[model samples]
Target: MKALTMARLLIRLFGVVALMTLNSVAARAEIAIAVAGPMTGQNIFRGEQIQQGAQLAVADLNAKGGVLGQRVQLLVGDDACDPEQAVAVARKLATDGVVFVAGHVCSHSSIPASKVYEEEGILMISPASTNPKLTDEGGANVFRVCGRDDQQGLVAGNYLADVWADKSIAILHDNSVYGKGLADETRKQLHKRGVKEAMYASYMPGKSDYAELVSGMRAVAIDVMYFGGYGADAGLILREANNQDFEVQLVGGDSLTTEEFWMVAGPAGEGTLMTFGADPRMNPEAAEVVDQFRAQNFEPGGYTLHTYAAVQAWTQAAEIAGSLDLMAVIKALRTHRFHTVLGEISFDQNGDVTAPGYVWYRWTKGEYVPAK
Candidate 1:
């Protein structure tokens, strides 16, 4: 009887140990990834794009058995496009055990957040932070799926100098890192191409009135204007110009790609031109995913597809490396070509995508289409 009781106790103990082991394995089966951006404040649209893209990517990857046989869990961080807030978000993501981050869309936010990611050994892939300093000053762990401001600026400046050279031109900036940096690059390229701007000025962003700036442009008889700012300020400037019966052609950077610009400028936004990567929605490879977004009533415009492609690139790199280890994934990113919705993508040593140069687009009938 005593021997039989001991045998029963040992059997129960083995079953308990097996149950705990299974629970431990189940807990470790999920891999955490993060998407950080300004989920609130003025640039919330961009953050929404980031969130949607990341969420979709996570869902699709999990449905396909995930990466490295582990399910992916996506965590979102709201930096509000503020630098200090971005750092806090980054630290939280690091603490949350995310091995990768796809975010902090604003250059100012990404630059500071990148340092935190570096220290915490988190890999970062920015989908829309274009300021060159993000890569110029960033650690090896940082990468961007978007073109740099310098690249986009060259396209803008040269287009202005070549096509609109006969017209009087003004260059204006909002003085933020992205705005000023892009403005300076465009200015540099214009100067290099022997074009002199009629007016160069800076304006405070987020103001309701830009009538005084319009007055200045009118005074100079500026026929073309290049604005280095987001859609909100750009819309106000255009509306004010239209109110004053000013007919200058408005040109801007990628931030003008959103429908908010049209919402703000109304009919005045009709002729505005901006530079951005060729529309990803028009890509044949993105048809399935684009349809998925449309079915959910989301337009995968602006940086939405870019953010999706960022995750795609990370997944491909991890697969190529055969591991999710930070250094292994970094090595794979540096050396492998990724087949993404953006087409085939490879990274340069600075972690910038090697495909898709910036192209011109013009607003027409409430939408931005490829320029003729």
Candidate 2:
């Protein structure tokens, strides 16, 4: 009888050890959140911002014991802001079993990557892609945490109409997806406000000389300009306009809200006005995250707040659905209001959040501040 009792106790101890080992394996199993962006090239800073924002989100999630009682992992890919590369990265992320994704920060990158995500039935949330076409593609799986280009354009147009009503304005764009889309929207809104411009011209990106465009504006006596493009073209235009003595108040979208814009445009960017979707410092709930980012010496920009909101939305959806299924999470994300650093967020039918969060900012004293 004693020998039989000893054998039974040993078997029970072995079973317990095996169960603990299985639980350990389950706890370590990774649920990856893929992060894609222009990790190389001229716009690398934008990709860095995306990575920083997502990393910060993952850290915060893990600090709070993570999602579904498992730690979150980030799998990053370099899309380089190229459309084809974006699609490839999306495919790779899908193959890697990445259920939740954040980014492909550029409009050009996000549009194509979104197609891949849609095909794979994977959920993707973009932090910075503002082109209307991204959400207009009719894919329910794709969502944007940032404001659409039309929304941002309206903000810029309203600012011009109210602040520089007496000034003659000209609209310029690089004819790219982001540039042309925003410029056209601004033009429509500006026309509605009866602020007709002196000239509306399309310029090719990376041109060394904008002399003809600048001279045409000079002839028209354009007093204020609304440019729709990235910092490179905007910087060139500012330099060439200055060379031709064409001084005007320049206003643009969130693309101009970067430190690189100021560095490239020099003093010309000093008075430039722009718009951003979310402000991190303004939110009370984001104070701890902001302090944490500053401690790590990371410059969290507009995308940082949006990325945090994306993670929050996903975590909330997971809890609501009680599953890690992508489709269920997407459904929950569309219908449920998720609390974020930017306040409560809920998506409309078009996968764009209906929030009155857009604000106009101007560069003053080396910092971007809203016009009082």
Candidate 3:
């Protein structure tokens, strides 16, 4: 009787062991995290940066056993920075069963994509969308890892107005949502600071020749120019202004900090000032990860650090939620303070990062050096 009992006990123990092993294997199975951005067209570079950063975060998270003990797989969607394309990508990502999404780098793209994610109950965290209206909608699932356009523009406008009070400043925009929005905000702030004699112009995008635009500023004897546009337009405008010997100070937002801006503008890029979300190499907490990204041949850019931080926040929120359910993750993200490579990540009621800040930088000698 004793021998028979021992045999039965051993069989039960073996069965339990086998079941546990299978469950562990299942736990290690691959899971998906979608990254949506402008993977093609003019803004593709920014999208690629966002993708690389999110990939870096996934690689690092997997190395540390990943979220929920499962490996993360990235699903890349190309929104082309178009509103309609963004909605399409968001719907596809939601239908494909991706637990989380980080991208739609452009604000215009993010605005429409957000609705899809919201309706699908997918957690969408934007690393580069800075439009105030994005998070102002009070969508529980919507979160931005960067500062708003209003904050960035206000900072730039105030700085210029206070430091260069006597200079004649001109404001130009590409007439796009982001460009016009930022330009109008900056103009408001500049006006409040008693800065006048400012020329505000909206240029039709895709126009390679900005000779007349630069000449118009010259005609007004403008000394400082604040441009709210992308690198392509800014580069051309700068090159044209330089060619025509406009001889003035030029400043812009994060869009002008790209390498393409320097490549296109060449010597015209000198003295160009801009703003960036955060620099991973300069962030003490992210220095090691920055090295790892560089080792992986990924050059970090403006959205790179923010995207990586967004992934970290998502993973932390998932752990806090104790489940992969989208609503649970969104609730956790709202209530929790996630420690990320970009430092502590927390959001306010408006879905914006708490105390989010932008760094002022200048292009000096073909490099974006932090402004003193």
Candidate 4:
């Protein structure tokens, strides 16, 4: 009787073990996706936007049974906007079997990391890396939901020529890939429009005081300054300019879209002009998603919707292709137009967005609005 009882107990234990193993295998069968960015750096705000956007995208997709009928596993990687760290994050995500990635916001991080995704057969869709070389020089696996610096530069340059033509235009860059590229593009457009800037300079970023630079600009009597850099540095420059009692019209690229600009410059940021894509949150098609974001007490601003749209495009392509193969998705993305928060959009041969470009905005009372 004791031997029989022990045999029955052993059978029950084996059955439990087998069921646990099966559950583990089932969990592993889901498709893995990731969102990577500067999650822990000074630029952590950008990462937060991407992370939140990806979270909603994945959640919404999963609610519909995910792509190809496989549930999606979402992973988050913090590259801190560093090139090497971005590559490391890419590799780690690849090893974890992530087939799709929707991040690496900074152009500096996105370009190098694209090489890794290319080698590892992962698809990457950047939401805010605007440096043209990202798509111009990257593998076919790379794509972006945002407009390029060249496109943004053209819009800014034409505005400068048309509106501030007689002002002594001063163009400045921060020596980073995004900054310099945007400055060069703006300068190029100015030249094309027969406008010559009074001062063109490069400055080191992350410096606290730009009083010396401000004094130099004051000496030149720069009327309008176009800074192709992030918000903090632009704010610092403007603040320094204000300190010297030298008020100038400050303009910047899309990087100034965040409130970080205002938080840094305060009242000095008033009347500052910037170039950004038309706000997607105001889109009629995005009403449901925007409402969903607000229900969580979060505002879907800046690149948040762009990131969401990137995931939307990828998932829609994968769904249409009925597979998650990199080439299949790429083909699907290129050949098909995706209706996203950004509206109907498709990619050109260079993997650049074939959509309409950028528009101008002006800061007033700590917020930005469409500029006339």
Candidate 5:
């Protein structure tokens, strides 16, 4: 009888061990994270940046043994910078079980997609969207690595008023949330500085011809133009103005920092000025990664490093929180300062990065550099 009892006890112990092993295997399966942006369309370059940055981050993290002992997997969503498509992408990612998302580059897309993410309990960290309403009206799960339009607008407006006060200035927007919001903020600051815009207009984006708009600017003899739009539209406007033989200087927001601007404007992009955070590729901490990017023949320009920093911040927060639980990670993000390629980054209550304010950059020789 004693021998039989001992045999049963051993069998029970073996069964318990087998159950625990299965659980451990299930836990180590995979952890999904997503990166979304305009992977197709006119803005595909920015999407490529987002993909490459996030891809590198995932590879590096997995090499070091991914978060919480599970291998990290990346899901790429192409919103194409469209608001409806962004919503669809967000839903798909949420359904795919991604705990975090770093994406939706356009402000219009980011704003709408944020609602879906919030409802699905997924954390979203936008690497490029800069409109203030993104944070102001966003839920706790939403965050951004880039500075707001208002902040950048203040810089642009002040710079214009201080340096081009004597020149006839015009403000133009693409009628999107990002473009209009930036233009309005710049206009506010310009008026506060006692500078009146000679023309304030909205132009439809994605059109090939802006000749009518160029004609209007020419008629007003506008010497300085502040465009609150993307590089594509801005480049077209510059090309059209130049084709009309109009000598107007163009200043814009961070969206103009891409090579697409030069590709579209050619010689017209020369001397174009814009505002963006100090380039992360120039950061000492980022030298190794930048070298890796260069070795791959990819220039980590525009929002590339920003997306990488977003992933870095998210992983650090998860490590600090000790779990991927949404609330725990959110608390960790709010309380801890993350050391990123962009330098030390901390978040405010509204989920905006507290480091690296906007600065001036100029397009010259087919690339943008710190403006002289």
Candidate 6:
């Protein structure tokens, strides 16, 4: 009887150990990916856009049995569009064991955070970071879904030369990496076309009043202002100009992609022109996802589709590689063309998307459409 009792206890102990091991395996069967951006600050909407896109993409991937049969676990980080904070967020994601990240919306954030991603052996794809240096200075893994500032600026400068050449044009930047880089490129092309700006200057961002700057443009009788800055500041400047009864056409960069630009500028934003990619929201490949967003009462505008494409590309690359190993996935990304809502995309030797470039957008009545 004693021997039988001991045997029964041993059997129960073995069964418990097997159950624990199975649970452990189940816990390890998920892969961690991250979407990071300014989750808080004046530009918190950017982070929300990144998160929404990533969430829906992950959902779709899981419904398709996930990547390599492993459930994808997503992480979120907030950089507040600050370089230092972005670096910190990258480090945290690394510590969290994330294998992939779609993040760092601003060029200011993306450029710095990319170093951490490279060092940690994580792949990063930016949905909207457009400064050339993010690719020119980034590692093998850094990529963007947006066109470079150089390309965007050329189009903008050429348009200005063609249409607004005779007007008194003033150029202003916010003195950040993205703002200044875009301003410089536009100015370079403007100079190439022999059209000199009436004023080239930097305005401090995050200020409530741009009255002084508006007065400067007014003093110069500036008929047009080419602003290389984010939408919030551009709208504020327009409001200040409008308040002062100074009528000046504001041509801004792609940062004005959101409806927030209109909300900030109000009626003052009427007829404002900005540069952005051809709207991916209008693409045929995007129709299903677009309908999904609309069903949820979300427009999925601006960089939302771009972020979705980033995830889609990474997903396809991982599946092609059949392994989440960094080098293997990287090789797959370089070799394969990914069909996304942004259309078919493939990475170049520099990891830049081999894709078509920029176009002009004009704000008419509260909505921005591809300019005619």
* Model 4 pairs in collision: none
- TM-scores of all candidate predictions against the true structure: 0.94, 0.89, 0.90, 0.93, 0.93, 0.95
Off by over 4 Å in 5: 1-28
- Best prediction by TM-score: 6
TM-score of 3: 0.90
| lDDT of the candidates, in the order given | 0.92, 0.82, 0.84, 0.91, 0.93, 0.90
Q: What local lDDT does model 1 show for residue 48?
A: 88
Give the per-residue lDDT digits (tens) of candidate 1, residues 1-372: 999999999999999999999988886798999999989988888888989999998899899999999999999999999999999999999989899999979998999999999999999999999999999999999999999999999999899999987889999998899999999999999999999999999999889999999999999999999999889889989999989999989999999988788889999999899999988888898999999999999999899999999999999899889998999999999999988878888999998889879999999998899999
Q: Residue by residue across 244-272, what tens digits does model 6's lDDT show?
A: 99999999888887777889999999999
Question: What would you estimate as the lDDT of candidate 5?
Answer: 0.93
3 against 5, candidate with superior TM-score: 5
Q: Using TM-score as the measure, name the better of candidate 3 and candidate 6.
A: 6
Which ranges of candidate 4 are over 4 A from the true structure? 1-24
Residue range 29-138, candidate 2, lDDT tens digits: 76788778888866777777778888888988888888888788889999988788888899999988788888878888889889888888888888889999999984
Better of 3 and 5 by lDDT: 5
Better of 4 and 5 by lDDT: 5
Weakest 10 consecutive residues, lDDT, candidate 1?
336-345
Whole-model lDDT, candidate 4?
0.91
> What is the Cα-based TM-score of model 1?
0.94
- TM-score, candidate 4, is 0.93
Cα deviation at 55, candidate 2, in Å, is 0.6
Q: What are the per-residue Cα lDDT tens digits for candidate 3 across 1-372?
A: 999999999999999999999987774487788889988888777887898888888888999998887888888999999899999998899887787899878788898888888888888899888888899973788998888889988898798888788988889988877888888888888888888746888898767798899899989999988898888788888899889878888888988767778888899888898977666567788888888888887768667888899999999999998888888887887788988877887987678898557778889887898888
Say which prediction, candidate 2 or candidate 4, comes out ahead on TM-score: 4
